[model samples]
Target chain A: MTQVSTTISKEKCFEQLLLGKTVKRVPGQYLSGSEGWLEAVRAEALENARALNFPSDRHDDWRFTDLSPLFQHGFQPVSSFAKLTPGDIEKFLIPGSTRLVFVDGCYDAGLSELGFSGSAGAHGVTVSSLVERIGDVQVETYFARQASFKQDAFAALNTRFFEDGAFVHVTGEAAAPIHILHVATRREAPSAIYPRCLVVMEPDSRATVVEDYAGLEDGVNFSDAVTEVVLKDDAQLQHVRVQRDEKNAFHIGHCSVAVGRGSVYAATSLAFGARVSRHDLHAVQMGEGAEIRLNGLALITGRQIADTHTRIDHAFPRGKSVQLHKCIADGAAHAIFNGKVIVHPGAAGTDSSQSSRNLLLSGKARIDTQPQLEIFNDDVKCKHGATVGQIDADSLFFLRSRGFSEERARNLLSHAFAAEIIIKIPVPSLVESLSRTILDRMSGVRT
Target chain B: MINKDSRVLLEVRNLRAEVVVDGVRGVEILKGVDLTVRAGEVHAIMGVNGSGKSTFSKVLAGHPEYTVTGGTATFEGRDLLALAAEERARAGLFLAFQYPVEIPGVSNSALLRLAYNTLQNERGLEELDPLEFEDLVLEKIKVVEMDASFLDRSVNEGFSGGEKKRNEILQMAVLEPRLAILDETDSGLDIDALRIVANGVNSLLTADNAVVMVTHYQRLLNYIVPDYVHVMDGGRIVRTGGKELALELEARGYDWVRAAA
Candidate 1:
């Protein structure tokens, strides 16, 4: 059996993904939006998506991750939404919390539950669809503002075609969390779905938002998502994002956040599934005396590939940021992490630190981790480190000497490695559920 | 106190072992070592550095780095060499490491409870729940005079040198093994810590258990009061006598033992 290498040009690849040649799945009514302001933005995004070439291994940023597997199979838009009940997604529903369910990138009003009068809650918080709140000033002002798609092809594609997503606006305080749940269903043919989210936190307001992307079945699919977050003065937002797609799926997600004066933005993102997954997170501290924290963990095995690229920009003086990202790759899995923290020239008195720690559980597993720090001011304090290693030999022997079987010892160490990030999630139930998922994944790991 | 007719807890005859040294294998560390430990006996094997005192203890505990090229070891008439490390642990053999490994992110209480539960299952006994086990751990922490806050921290992470050794003793108190090997357990302890650690080990001794302390200094003998002392020279036990021999070794260096051998 000879393996053939087909060198398809980037222009042809883009044409195959976007041109109306494969399959047109969305209904005409779903594509029409009342907001005329978005039409120009969508048009601009379409042109950008066409002009920019799909990144290849030659691209320095995408050197380790390959996109050929995604292009190998043609994906059609999800034509019809799957019929799902609350019981069908019971595991995803946070008890008594407001939730917005999107099945195959199409909003499912029947499955979503909004407290107070449908989408309007206490403390002047509004959790509704972007299309429904088209005329709102804040939604119109903040949507498609923070996440720039002119340079990123995937982000551009999501901007050009996303039908509907959640629009969350907090005024005073939101005690109950708002969950944006994206559930991918098993499709007859390989499909592509776009999920988008926009969050705006008002001055001195506090809220917690959980963005979860999960699948109902282990089927071939593509999830291209973009989330934009903006925090005003003295605001605090605890954001938790989890990606648990199907085993044979492809996921490309980008989240860009703009933090305001004296505000705080903390995020914890975890990835567990998907044959090939990539997440690009960018947080810029645009205001002085602001604090930002970004924690991520990727637990993947088999031939899975999980790539995480993050950048924290301290653009203002007296800003602080802390980031810790970890990965546990088993089997022949590959995990990549690139964390860059830039302290701008005028950003004096900036205190920032970043660390990327990875664990390889097998000889065949691979990890490429790099911590890049660019400091332009000598008055700032920045530290960064990276480590890629197997499980500690002495720790393993210590557990074994305490009467734990070798397999159990390995699982415990791996669980502890992933739990350092899981314990930071503000939701208790989500932490418990994610812990069980990690343990189940690590149980089958031989090393 | 040594009994004349008590059960032979651990018996080793002509034990030979080798460990890799600087990427080279088959470097014999323990050569022709023989020893016997009866129930209720505390024996201290004193040796200079590179004399393979730690090697002999690790060999008995089934450390994977050491290959037992020849010889036989038995615990209560069962073949100890054939068992794995954890198997040896479940068979009531415990070795207190000189440099305890610090495992970050694993709470000390979690490790203790899991190890205790695993040993319970091995003995066909009921496992303790978290609540029940917390009560037991609180009581055991007093044996080593450890603060309760240590249980909530990661296992041995950022612990001071003396504190790490005491943590080892705390684990020993929790497991209550039949035959305990203290491998250089007194290397880094201050005077007060030495007393507390010695008192902890002394209190755990019973008529059905034995202890083998491998050390270079005789100061620890003043507190634990071993019943017998053996001087190891060139990977072999050259002299064996009552505790008075430790005092003699303190008076004269180990060179006398090497010359006598």
Candidate 2:
């Protein structure tokens, strides 16, 4: 492990970074298994962070957001914690499937329970800590191949640390969905938790997994995590992520999925918490006859800021993908969405579309949406659109004329806007719960 | 003194309006039109496409696109022009749009409740909660003979031409305005849907309320009879006659009336 020395004060990390001074990179402390990809990831992290230089208020992309929360608290590398126990695992289980729990930055075996009970981890289903599986030659080759460090800074940071993350392998003919629950428990101030999950589904396999980010207490905590997904030929995977943290927490995460030939991948991301949270998703259809569907919804209130950036790359012919993301911004909060669909030169038969719509509840609330589509192949069909506006006044008047109060009218309109996306979620129970949460949030009712 | 049975519900004297566009200027669309609709009577206004039939309804509804340069409308002896569009709606005035706007995220039932509650508040009546409101709308849904699923769908979204018109009548049934103005309600319906919509309107009519049906054809009048039919051209009523006037226009066509006038 290599440790770099830093001359800047802990409180001035963001300021020094903004000034273009080369601050010392954090120590590379691999947990006995990430040696192969450690050096490459660390170099990439330092270069990317230097390029970003801690965005200021002048940056148009981030002008509406106040980044003071990131600098108000310092960052510390967290690896081992004593608060999480086996009992906590029972309360966090997703019900009806296998559960994997990671506390702080290390995978806790005692805190995880496999649902099969008497049956051992069966054929084509391999779940273990990343440290235990890094010796495999396949893991070494595919670690940083699907994920690029230049596109996202947080992914680079998670890769540089290269600690113990979850590694699940689904071999040929696997049917069941692998559920990975990444739980972050905060204990001290200015603490950082870097938890990562790497999933590889082999040919002719199917699986479902959930990446949950939550905080048990209210503290000044930071969670920087990344998940990399690779699907082999004819494999299918369903991924659902729920982000609900403390009001004072800062969370930055990324999910990168690469699909193979004749494969299918569907993912849903529901973001509802964190003072300053951002999630970036990058999906690449690398083979023919590959399909992907992405559905995302965010309910924001208070002074929180949630941003989601997605890029779907069609690298081959006969690839199709659809992305729909909706946001409801209330209070003084701001929501940002940037979705881009690109068709490479040889991807002739690609069909892709993306739409982003936002409902602003107050005049002071803000929403920024940008949908971009670039096509190098003329034979392909692609469309992209974005809309950001307040609730329709005529519609409100029309509703009010029927006898609804001001509050009831607002509630119904906001709920319907969010429900358009929520109803498309595959999980019925989660959809119901999310709808209730959205209604409650809009009505200012406590959960 | 106004007779008890002949009490006037709506009165418009020398009503003049101009169309405003681009915030720069305006053009007169209504030139001193006079109209009086009494209770227990249905008034039919027949006019050409650009004869300001729709504009008259919008002006009465206080649409921001049109400015009333000089006019006075007394509804139940209250100044109608002083109120906003929504205020007028709450004060027992309803205008069924020629083309109902589709609100993508608002459900039909929810919109109806909002209108109902706003009218209640204006009239000093109690408001109904969600459960009670749903029940109220369910009864009206059956009266319009609309499907139960239509209540859950978005307002006018993906509705067929007939369904949209029927939804407008459903709204009329639920709101129960004292003076209902149907603006070109029969333009986009087939024979069957047209009969259904006209029947829905006829069922809602009472001795204490008045209706003003604006149409370009006499097809709708075959079902919903009008007590008095007015011929309007170039922004003003040219002639007034009995219900048989619609039949006479249907048999003789509009050119004969233009020739006779």
TM-score of every prediction relative to native: 0.94, 0.79
DockQ of each: 0.52, 0.21
Segments of candidate 1 deviating more than 4 angstroms: A1-13, A19-32, A117-121, A444-447, B21-26
Q: Which is the leading candidate under TM-score?
A: 1
lDDT of 2 at B25: 45
- Candidate 1 lDDT by residue in tens digits, A202-314: 99989899999999887888899999999999999999999999898899999999999999999999999899999999999989988999999999999999999998999
Best by lDDT: 1
Q: After superposition, how far is residue B181 of candidate 2 from its true place, in Å?
A: 2.5
Residue B186 shift from truth in candidate 2, angstroms: 1.5
Evaluate model 2: give its TM-score.
0.79
Compute the lDDT of residue B251 as modeled in candidate 1.
96
Model-by-model lDDT, in order?
0.88, 0.76
